[model samples]
Target: MATEKLGIRVERNPPESRLSELGVRQWPKWGCEKSKFPWTYSAKETCYLLQGKVKVYPDGAGGGEEDFVEIAAGDLVVFPKGMSCTWDVAEVVDKHYKFE
Candidate 1:
């Protein structure tokens, strides 16, 4: 069977130049979070992690197997609308996030 992937889309070490070129910083910034918690996205979101590490587990509410995605500083991540996930922040999590 073909496994289904949901929730996250990741781009490793996206070029800093690309970040500036796309004006990613123009979006509002979210401060570093020291605590881990579950988050549900009400809308599609794209973000750039400025620091820290995180592991996000899908709770299987999106019609696929439960799985996890690893995130870290310099990674660009996209979260689909209405996705349910638990975030296990392994370190201080800092990022800039914007909702669609």
Candidate 2:
């Protein structure tokens, strides 16, 4: 699924074969406990969540209830380069990520 305007893309429960094709397991891992933080994507990023729950609010969105996109375990997500946003992590997160 794609989040409008934010340009974030999410693929839920992608097949293992696809993960293997993407070499997701070889990507570096990153994780954090529940928290909220702002971020700016300097480069395009693709990640596969091993576990977690999060909502991403785009820059200038005013953090509105309707302006965020939810993501969680089993999701493969992409953040476009130069996207500024905030992450509201509701559960501990573990993911493999690669920047391009």
Candidate 3:
């Protein structure tokens, strides 16, 4: 699913071959404790979640529950350049990511 307004896209449980094609395992890995933080994407970022759950709220979302996008383990997610948002990590996150 793609959220055009926030320029974020999510692909759930992408095939292993697709992951291999993207060299996902070679991408730098990042992991964080369960927490909430604000983030701004200075460049386009594509990441594949190895484990975790998250809700990303675009800037100016006024803290509305419906304004966030949910992402989870086994999901491939992309955040566009210049997008500013808040990340609410409900579960510890472990992922492989690359900036484009």
Candidate 4:
């Protein structure tokens, strides 16, 4: 069966941590609890996860009907503008994010 995938782009554990430095320079760091949450992006966002792991699914997706993406420490993720998704945070997370 074919499955739909969220339009998030991820660079896993990027080399030299370039994403980390860019994120920190662009925005203030943010932290979140270990939990599941729903979110909609009003503006495009690019983020670097400093710590923790997460599984994110696009809206209205479940039961293995759609593909989800994982973002973890040292990962660089880009959430497109106007995208809506759910986040399953497996651990407390610290990230630096910037919106455009």
Which is better, 1 or 3, measured by TM-score? 3
In the range 1-100, model 2's lDDT, one tens digit per residue, is: 4343458899988899999999999999999999999999999999999999999998876766789889999999999999999999999999999999
lDDT, residue 87, model 1: 85
Local accuracy of candidate 4 as per-residue lDDT tens digits, 11-55: 776765575457455677888999998899999988888898999
**CA lDDT of each candidate?**
0.79, 0.91, 0.90, 0.79
Candidate 2 — which pairs collide?
none
Give candidate 1 regions above 4 Å deviation.
Answer: 1-5, 61-66
Q: What TM-score does structure 3 among the candidates reach?
A: 0.91
Q: On a 0 to 100 scale, what is the lDDT of residue 36 in model 3?
A: 95
Can you write out model 1's per-residue Cα lDDT over 1-100, one digit (the tens) per residue?
1122454788878888978876789888886566678888999988888998988887774523446888889888888898888888888887888899
Best by TM-score: 2
Candidate 2 segments exceeding 4 Å error: 1-5
* Model 3 segments more than 4 A misplaced: 1-5
How far off is residue 14 in model 4, in Å? Answer: 1.6
Model 4 misplacement above 4 A: 1-5, 20-26, 61-66
C-alpha lDDT of candidate 1 relative to the true structure? 0.79
Model 4 CA lDDT for position 45: 89
